[model samples]
Target: MPTTRNFRTRRRRLSWPLIAGIIMLHLAALYGLARALAPDFTAVVEREVVSAFTVTITAPPDPPPPPDNQPEPDEGAAGDPGRDAVPQPVTGQPPKVRVKRDDPLPRASSTGTANQSGAATAGDGTGAAGSGLGTGSGNTGSGRGGVAVTKPVHISGSIDNARDFPVPPGGRAARRGTQVIVRVIVTPDGRARDCRVYRPSPDPEADRITCQLVESRLGFRPATDANGNPVAAPFYWRQEWF
Candidate 1:
């Protein structure tokens, strides 16, 4: 009866490991919450910096030119207003250059006349001895002395009738030797006009009759000038009465 009192004993429901795991889970949750809600400690800064650099360009040197020694022309020498005026700058177009032409030769030296020397150069006659230029010859070849006659007109045989000619009457001694000299003008149209007796025959009737026949019924080949133009020519002739 001295030790008869009953004692109650309880069994463990949860282990110590379980209790420890529960405590670790609670610490991780609290750490995550604190990290999410905590203030940021990182710093941010904004700055503007200007950068500068220097650049250099170099040019090539030009060659030196020769120096001019001639003196400039005097502008005031002539006292011309246009020449003395200041030269205006031309910008729209290029400057114009003037070209000069030389003058022609004078009249004295320009014309060359044919002389003896020129004649020696030209031939005269048909054969070698005669085949040299004659004395002073004109352009028309009338030469120098004499009448300067070109081509003399002849009496036409067809137009001059024998019956129309003068009898040239004279004295018995001078009849056959009687001579008549006359000058006639031949027109450009081949008409013989202005007949005059320069030297009459011994017989006056013969002289008058000769002049009349020449003026009325004579035809001539007109002469030409140096220029080859047909013109009236004065002709002289002498006739001996037969």
Candidate 2:
């Protein structure tokens, strides 16, 4: 047995419009991809931001007015007589004066008597005992009631007259003619009782020997009062030694 075969065939053709539409779609997609991948050319503009605030300012208050009760100065009172007057200076008390005093003269005679009762007491013409100024029997007032000293103490003889003075070993090296001053106290008998150096020499040995030489060997004339009586007194002795 033979079977019959049936074959159906349909043929479709692409039209020009369909092909153009597909090509235009592909071209549009390619253009969109290019546009997304490529860099954009846009203009860049800088914008500055500014901030504003509101502020309130107030001025200081006005000064207060003067008081109504205050009195004004008088311009006419500037020429007042008391304001132009000169003031007198005050005087102080004067200083006191000092009086001079005269002392009474001393007398050796017992007949003289000084009356101290009044400042004007007058003495006898012979100057025995009145407070008045007159010639007296004594030499002069000792400044005290005793007789005044007439002669002062002095060296009797040359200092070379003393016993041989031995110089120390180093005496030659000292300054030549160095002077030493010593104070010697003499008794009424014209003998030196005490001695001390008043002024020192440049050499120490000279000063040490001065007192010993003055007290041991030096002699002095005793000081005499106005009545020629001997009295103890001090004498200054100056000597040169190497």
Candidate 3:
């Protein structure tokens, strides 16, 4: 019975120590919870103290125009405003020209009239002497320089491929003849000067070939005077095919 009483005293002492340990554990848990839920004073003060600002922009007003009394610059005046202030005068005068008159002829008198009458009478053989004097014997009713004028002589010829006067291409068919009237200017030296084809063929090819042939091959003997001398006379030639 004494042992049982001692065991109950020891249980009471152990129960008091356990109660103190439980109380210390509960106080530590409450301190951690309070620290976790509390606000950060330094971060709150920094965020609250910062500030932001907004700005607005505006355009400037235009300046006033310049005065009108100032003279505007001239592009062609080389920066000098008074350069065109001078006035110019014009002079008038007539152009000079030289003039001269022909000399007057001598006046006719009775003596001069009589002399001219005698000269005319002698020339016509109506003077006292019935023979005409001071005249050329060769002065007949012929042309100038005593050369007898003859009529224009006409000559005719032909341009053909068969005869080959101009020698056509070999083995080619002979083209039909083209008649061309050629007028030739006969010079004083008996040579042809200006030879022209006055009339051409109806066919272009025939006209070209005929004109070329006539201009190359045709010639003539000049006409003769009464003295049997070749004279400067006109002539003509005709080219045709039968």
Candidate 4:
């Protein structure tokens, strides 16, 4: 039998372009299928990605100093009302009015006898004793009075918290001296539940943004009552742009 040589099959490597083309074709087919399933794929709203900035307003510069040599204005003198009036000569004998003389006090007679009954009583214009009001205690009720409920005390709330606001594009209505006052309603769970613009800024959008920012960033512990019970309360804070 003659000897025969066996050769192994050679493996070929794919070119980068061919590989990229295959990948692109596969992606295209997948995209077509996805588009067919859902035509309005892009209609879903997504969270906007934006850069945030903390805004603060700088205090206005101190007013210019007054001139050192400025003359002080003198205050007007107060005039006496009677100074200009001339006294009328005795006003015709002072109008002749009669004054009644008080009569002398009556003297107690020696023949009058003292009260025969010996029961003692006391009264200082208040009332008779035990007539529903002579007791020293404040209230007439025998039971102790109820404690008064004072206003709720705020345990924790950020009044001066620096908040982050998204910087809008093109700087529209983002000028200085703009401020918005927001009222945040804090629940008993120490969370900000609702927010509304208490005082709106010049720009309407600024007022809306103020509420949104407060609802997301602001945190507060509910106001506590005199008995330390947590309650829902509104907290006001201001944000200004500069």
Pairs that collide in candidate 4 are none
Q: Compared with the true structure, what per-residue lDDT tens digits does model 4 show for residues 158-242? A: 3243344444555635546678887776655666656877888777776786777666665665565555555556677788876
Worst 10 residues of 2 by lDDT: 41-50
lDDT of 4 at 211: 75
**Candidate 3: deviation at residue 2, Å?**
99
Q: Which lDDT tens digits does candidate 1 get at residues 1-242? A: 68887887988689899999999999889766666676242111111112223346677788788798899888767654564677888878767777786654444543555322323433564222232333343342332212323564765733234354544334345657668898987765667778899998777776777777777766778777666645567887676655
Instruction: Provide the lDDT at 3 for model 1.
Output: 83
Clashes of each: 2, 3, 0, 0
TM-score of each: 0.34, 0.38, 0.29, 0.31
What's the lDDT for residue 185 in model 3? 54
Q: Write the per-residue lDDT of candidate 3 for residues 78-131, one digit (tens) a residue.
A: 653565666688787877776876654445555453423334322433232323
lDDT of 1: 0.60
Better of 1 and 2 by TM-score: 2
C-alpha lDDT of all candidate models, in order: 0.60, 0.62, 0.51, 0.58
lDDT of 4 at 206: 61
User: Judged by TM-score, which candidate is best?
Assistant: 2
Q: For model 3, what is the error of residue 68's alpha carbon versus the real structure, in angstroms, after optimal superposition?
A: 99
Error of 2 at 11 (Å): 61
Q: Highest lDDT: give the candidate number.
A: 2
| Model 3 Cα shift for residue 200 (angstroms) | 2.2
Model 2 regions lying over 4 Å from their true place: 1-66, 72-148, 151-155, 161-163, 169-171
